[model samples]
Target: MSAIITVENVGKKYRLRHQKTETYATLRDTIVRGAKNVFSFNKVDKPTVEEFWALKNVNFEINQGDRIGIIGRNGAGKSTLLKILSRVVHPTEGRITMEGKIASLLEVGTGFHPELSGRENIYLNGVILGMTRKEIQKKFDEIVAFSEIDKFLDTPVKRYSSGMFVRLAFSVAVHMEPDILIVDEVLAVGDAQFQKKSAAKMESISKDEGRTILFVSHNMPAMEKLCPTSIYLEHGTVKKIGKTEEIVNEYLIATNAQ
Candidate 1:
């Protein structure tokens, strides 16, 4: 099978500011400083700026119909990598090549109009995913049923609980039938039953429909069950890419030793 996505030397850089801490000064010292500032050139303290690489020199290729799990500890750049893949953010020093329409659920309410009703947002998300009105309409009923938010269909999504928001968002993304599906830890907000249902759905899509999936989650069992291959990330770099069980074991051992 051909590779559906290729990431080459991908890196994302961010600038972080650190406030300078001032030592305690007496009232007299403060008055003298103020007087000096009034008579002399006004000097302002600037926060220290540091360049932080959220991801650096990351390279990977995902074949079509691959169910790949991205595993990492906090601040490992998993989310940043996903954002880059989904085109929510751009890499600073590398390139990515993708060959499919992508539907992503990176956050609970991503790609959703908070003020719009669930029914409206479904159509909006589908259209954004490159579906036409007729195509979205054809899948509308299935989306609503999967979401199990029928009673709230006409209600504004801003009023929805996080669980409801994820349900509706996942429902729309999956029903739109994109060739690549990207999901992050936002699914953890849903109930266990819902999470299980979502895993099953993702599995079905990848196996039966030949869709590619990139999943990121802290839930180890779920990740192992859903992904045949996995990538372990640490400190903004790829640590390993191989069988899910081996990667998961290595990650757990390293995490425990820390």
Candidate 2:
């Protein structure tokens, strides 16, 4: 039970631009604006830039086979932290070390190509998750069976509904036998039955397979049941990390106070 993942003093910063002019302009418009700024006597106001910190001084260590839940109000950087851990985005400060392969289902069709058929995206996403073609093939049928998207397997994923995308993506991610699994709130798109199935699957994998999981969700009960440990984030910082029920209750009280 050594630590499988370590996040040290992580922080992410985003620059928010507030511009009076349109953010996107055609080539002709850009040229014209450039000429005005270069030669015209009129002065143009510059867009205002604001610095926003999505995560600040966040630090944690996840043990092998640990099931951890992340909870926070909107804008608390929970998703940002997950993205950093998934390598989809890097932190503006600090460093992270990971010991094993990771599969992340952060959003609908996260690593999928919209123009690719469902079957194609499955292989494509599987590869991105560090699975070899042979490994993916071995689990192909199981993934398809769990997703229940066989009929639409040949269809381009662009045609799929959000729920369909989530089902297929989740299926491939979890079935890939990744050492670490990261799931965000995209599971909300699935139906209730599917959510239950997903929760059960996550629970089983962590217990039976010794897989590590980092889950982010607003469903308090599900988080409590699936994750024995939880972290509560507030204003882009780690507010608390401890037993799931205790952290959940503290979050509820804090949220109610605001």
Candidate 3:
């Protein structure tokens, strides 16, 4: 099968500034500081900027219908890589190429408008995913039933509980039928039954429908169940990539050593 996603030497950098003075200053204080600086022989030093690279030199290729798990300790840059793939953020360096349409559920209520009711946001999110009105309407009832939010369908999502928000968002994302699905750990917000449903749905979509998937999770058992291959990230680099069991075992050993 042809590869659906390719990532090459991807890196993301963030700049942090350290300032000596308070961020907010009154007009009078600002004037006095300016005068003092001008009169003094020594000039005030500028704030220092530090560059932090969250991801560095990452490379991978994912084929169509592949179910891959991404695992790492916190601050491993897993989230950063996913954000780049989802097009939420651009990489500081390197390149990524993807085939077909992409739908990502990186967090709860990712594309939802809080002021809009669940019913309205469904259409809005569908459009954002490149679906036409006809496509959204045809799947509307099925999406609502899967989410189990029919009672609050007309209620603004701002009034929803976190669980309700996740359920509704996940329903819309999966049913939209993108060529590739990227899911982060947001499924942890749902109840056990809902999590099971989500896992099953993802498995079905990748297997039966031949859609590609990128899944990130702390749940080892769940990853073991849903993913045949795994990538272990450590300190913004791919430490290992292979069969799920081998990669997961290596991760466990490293964690114990830590």
lDDT tens string, model 3, 1-258? 778999999999987667665666579867876787788777565446789999999999999999999999999999999999999999999999999999888876657999999999999988887688999999999999999999999999999998898899888888988899999986675899999998999999999999999999998999999999999999999998999988888888989998
TM-score of every candidate: 0.85, 0.86, 0.88
Q: Candidate 1, after superposition: displacement of residue 182 in Å?
A: 0.9
Question: What does candidate 2 score on TM?
Answer: 0.86
* lDDT score, candidate 3, position 19: 65
Q: After superposition, how far is residue 227 of candidate 3 from its true place, in Å?
A: 1.0
1-258: candidate 1 lDDT, tens digit per residue: 778999999999998766543455468766765777677774443346789999999999999999999999999999999999989897899989999788787765556899999999988877876678998999899999999999999999999998899899887777778899898876565798998888788899999999999999999998999999999999999999999999999999999999
Which candidate comes out best when scored by TM-score? 3
Model 1 lDDT on a 0 to 1 scale: 0.88
Greater TM-score among 1 and 3 belongs to 3
Clash number by candidate, in order: 0, 0, 0
Model 2, span 1-258: residue lDDT tens: 678999999999998878665666579876776777778677464446799999999999999999999999999999999999989897899999999888888875667999999999999998987789999999999999999999999999999998889899988888978799998976565899998898888899999999999999998999999999999999999999999999999989988998
Query: What TM-score does candidate 1 reach?
Result: 0.85
Cα RMSDs, all models: 5.6, 2.9, 3.1
Name the TM-score of candidate 3: 0.88
Q: What does the lDDT read for residue 178 in candidate 2?
A: 79
Instruction: Write down the lDDT that model 2 would get.
Output: 0.89
